[model samples]
Target: MSFDQLASELQVRKAASLYRGRKVLQSPQQPEVVVDGKAYLAFCSNDYLGLANHPAIVSAFKQAADEYGVGGGASSLVSGHSFHHHALEEELAAFTGRPRALLFSNGYMANLGTVNALLGKQDAVFQDRLNHASLLDAGLLSGARFQRYLHNDVDSLTQRLSKTQARRSLVVTDGVFSMDGDIADLPAICDVANHHKAWVMVDDAHGIGCLGKTGAGCAEHFGLSEQQLPILMGTLGKAFGTSGAFVAGSDVLIETLIQHARTYIYTTSMPPAVAAATRVSLKLVQTEQWRREQLTSLIQRFRRGCEQLGLSLMDSPTPIQPIMIGNADKAMAMSAALRDKGLFITAIRPPTVPHGSARLRVTLSASHTEVQVDRLLDALDQVK
Candidate 1:
């Protein structure tokens, strides 16, 4: 806690080229945005279907705000759970085809609360080594015997699960990994989980509303059922183009979280207006299949372009396509060069990925046109 120690740590980070900074966005979350007073063609957004700025969603937000004011006013158990919150939960349950769905303020809380609620000292929680930081932190804090298997390696997971002596076992993973963008082998993982009698929890934050025929996320993408994958968590802020997150499962699992999840019990509810807006976004996500089509086309175009350019790309079929630049300094330089070309893509540096695998995380959205994608390609060519 000493000041000198803190300063030394910061200096170490800067020296290692691991320092990070935030961009000041002056426009809505879209393909085109103004950052720090400069207009740029942005390619690093999670608004996969591009409903973040859709007129219908905005109108819904405005209308709900007029009716419900701003905040949820209190925790749900105390009184903050309004009609909007209730209705959204019901809609989400139906949307995910689950027996029931419980809403959390955000994805992090949803993960932490659910894991902490389900696992205890005598339980064992096995997670993917590449799972999100929130999931890792939750597992560590859950007071369980936490074991991380090799990333997406079912053999490693099965080996670890078979040796567990804990009373309960849970296997958790990200449906679509946030950084690498590769998908978890959920069906195979479920097969292993079933063999060991361990419950599988999938945090499909990046997969939902972007995958599957109806955008039900990786479970639907792989056709896995509620019984096979019992714990399902998804974030609305990403592909759904809204805020907050949800956990969907059997009625009993949700009731267990409601009774024991400390994060949910202690936190104030997300704004009712946000939930109202999410309802509209959810509907569009289901009915507007054209957006997903357009997004897939863009992703294919970008991948082909990158392949032709000989730029290193990840094996990701989703909108998240990362161009790996091995060194952190080189990654930062590449990002700066793109910015100079009026393309606003961010460099993801070390500690986020492995020390040597810093990358340019290029994401595509349905709001983007082919011309815009071509412009990004041109910028990449010039920069590299």
Candidate 2:
């Protein structure tokens, strides 16, 4: 209740090796950036397709700003629903092959809005143990009987589904685990959700614009029908290189969310210019199949190289490649060693991830060349 209590809390965080910090980036979000007066090739950004600094996206953003101005002055429930937001929703609906889509300010908001809107006191929410923090928080906020199934374990979900007596059920998971770099078993989970009559929602924050043949996220990558993964959440800031998020689903679902989602009802909408820019990026993401191809090749290259160095890596097909360096201190040591070698990567530690699984999350982007990946592999050889 006092300032000393806050200071003591910060001290406890420091002692627990979980104090977080931000780096000052002097350059754009690209393969190479200037951070803290030093230039380094960073592998920590979420810009999977490398369009964060693409000329066309920049031009689109600038042009839209000229036409639409900045900021949505009111919430969408009032008068802030502009043409740009509507168009982006249409584009996203078509992109994900869903009947409708609803926009939220960010992936976090999208998850919270969707989860809390659909399930309340009478319903239950089941989630994968390793789903994103936002999903877990959303479930808690929903006042449902929130339960976490074993990570990516379909049998666990089946057992829980058979036992639960809640009137309505919602099953949630990350299409790709944020920190572990492993994918959820979508096919198995879908089967369980289908058999149990529970609604399925997937937070594909890290999957969109990085998976599928045309960057349609994990549902498309796995060839699952929209009916199979009815509630899909995709963020624009990651692979699309823009800000905001959208939920794609059946028309009834979108209508319900537009009426019921508290986050969407109360908060100001995303800028019209951001929607305009994201529209351009979405087109490029859908048309540019080469980006996913190259990114996959790079992930494979890095995995093979790490294997040769006897470094353990997670089983992931996406851009998130987390090396399994066990101890927190050693993970920090390895991250520092790479930083000194002109490479910038964050040392992921507990509460962001589980203790002893702390390691470097080596993210790949379409902007990075094969040679750059090989150089990274070579530098990592030093750790071996």
Candidate 3:
């Protein structure tokens, strides 16, 4: 096809109900926010712990700014790493019960860097079919024998594992699926990986700082040991209510990444302010257990209310709830309708989700109120 033909194809995407657009947020991360100059009740952020706009985190970030200036100014290998980054890594290691931790610019970088750095060509990488795009992309970039198992199916992973007799095999999965809002069976996956003599990697990007006591993440929530579930990746931008991501594991793992993870070695570290703010967020996630309690109660209330409304909500105990709408048009329409009623939930469509499984990904936060959930349900009732 010619260049003009390729341009035409792009236009067809917009015509075919598949193109996506972003809304500009003009206010802080909160239940009620100003998006594109309009006020709405937002159910779209990953800020489950609601520390994104917390006064303490804000103050800490500002104080760090006063001390450290703006950017890292260079890569860590060349003088970018700071005391704030160092402290955040230590706190992350303790939080996740790991010997050490290393931070990346984002969850995408952490997953890609870790997966690519660990196993390479001729090795085997088994991933959940619905694992994040970052993991899938990492597997491709690593030149590994990438095989996707059925989503959340440990047996499928084992079956694929049985097929591969490579020198290194890593089974990777998302602890909490970003779009589906479903939890992966980590215990079963870890057991299968162990039985097969393979390594397990959990990308608890949305699970950490949201589920477990002390907000340690899915492994802690399931009571799995660090030995049982090594190679854990957590994102600070989500429930941690800050920016960047980290890999938590033994000293060897962190050292290996420090030496070989291209993403971390090459990119400038996250701003010191982010690390400083994350320290504040971590303390709150540890001591302020009431936030978790409130979140749990809200999740239960939302699930029950959705059930009573006969809405098809995913079986998610966490605050990430998905209402499967099945078609892109319907999903987009649902989101638009809800937005019209002053609710700001976004519709997720392919390729963010599977074909024919478009959905409204409704996320909750500790800042959300029962009245807000009830109001969202009311909008759902009218839209449905």
Candidate 4:
């Protein structure tokens, strides 16, 4: 437990090109941003709909702040559950086509609280191999028999489900894989889960504000009913352009979380202003078909450009496009080269991804222009 061991590990990470660092952003969350005193056209943000700095959402936040003041003051079980919080939960339930929805401080807490509440040592939890770190951590902490299936392979999930003899089984996956940008086969997964009598939970953090005709998320996109996806979790900070996360499910599921989810029961509720702002964001997500349309156009344009360049790309049809680079050093070097070319895209290295699957994660937004995407393609071509 000496400090020298920690220092040695840091050195090893830096040597392996796996050390992570933060870039100070001097501007708002948008396509054009100033980071560390330099301006660049950024493609690394999760703001898929370009609503982070939207006027209406910002105005709503300010107005709610003026009325409700700044802090949450207490946990939801206490006096902190504001009118905005309650109203947003109801709206989210309707939007997600569920009986009820409960809010959490963020996506991590939502996942941690929900899984732990639902399962115990007598139960079993199965997750996709490529699930987010939060989901993986939640499963580990749940003290349940944990198993990971092959990424997005329904047969793998079904085979594992058949072998598990736990009293209860829960299968979890991300609606959209954050690193590879591919979507989950929700319909197939749901069918397998139904056959096995297991519950299906989808964390649609990256899919909520970008998919579906009305932007209700992957469940809506796949036309899955509440019974098909019993526990659905989505984050507001991504496409919704606000903060916090929520779980939408049946009344019993939600009530169980409210009572048993330590992360929800202990933490201070999200600020009322964020809830108010997200209310507006939710409305925009539903009404504005153009945002999704624009994102689709950009995704297609970028993919075609990469294909023309003969660059290796993933099977993602979503905004999160990744350029496959096998070596960690090469991924980091390519990211540095892009930064030098007046563009910003992060190199995703292990263990964020698997070993030897390093990549440049290129996220698109409705705020990005065709010309900007072309510039990114040009940079990739030059670096490659």
Model 3 residue-pair collision total: 0
For candidate 4, write residues 1-384 as lDDT tens digits: 579999999999999999999989999999999999999999999999999999999999999999999899999999999999999999999999999999999999999999999999999999999999999999999999999999999999999999999999999999999999999999999999999999999999999989999999999999999988999999999999899999999999999999999999999999999999999999999999999999999999999999999999999999999999999999999999999999999999999999999999999999999999999998888999
The TM-score of predicted model 4 comes to 0.99
Model 1 per-residue lDDT tens digits across residues 201-292: 99999999999989999998999889999999999999999899999999999999999998899999999999999999999999999999
Q: Give the count of colliding residue pairs in each prediction.
A: 0, 0, 0, 0
Candidate 4: residue 201 Cα off by (Å): 0.4
Residue 200 miss distance in model 1 (angstroms): 0.4
Cα lDDT of model 2 by residue, 21-127, tens digit = 88899999999999999999999999999998889989988998898788888999898888989998998999999999999999999999999999989999999
- Give the CA lDDT, 0 to 100, for residue 280 in model 2: 92
Residues 1-384, model 3: lDDT tens digits: 369987888798777678878779999999999999999999999999898999999999999999998798889888999999999899889989999999899999999899989998879999999999999999999999999999898778878998897989999999998888889999999998998889999999989988787888899999998889989999999888889999999999889999999999999989999999999999999999999999999999999989999999888888899998999999988889999999999988888888999989999999999999999999999999
Model 2 TM-score on a 0 to 1 scale: 0.98
Q: Model 2's lDDT to the true fold?
A: 0.91
lDDT of 1 at 10: 95
Candidate 2 residues lying further than 4 Å off, grouped into runs, are none
Clashes of 2: 0
lDDT of each: 0.95, 0.91, 0.91, 0.96
Candidate 2: minimum summed lDDT over ten consecutive residues — where? 13-22
lDDT of 4: 0.96
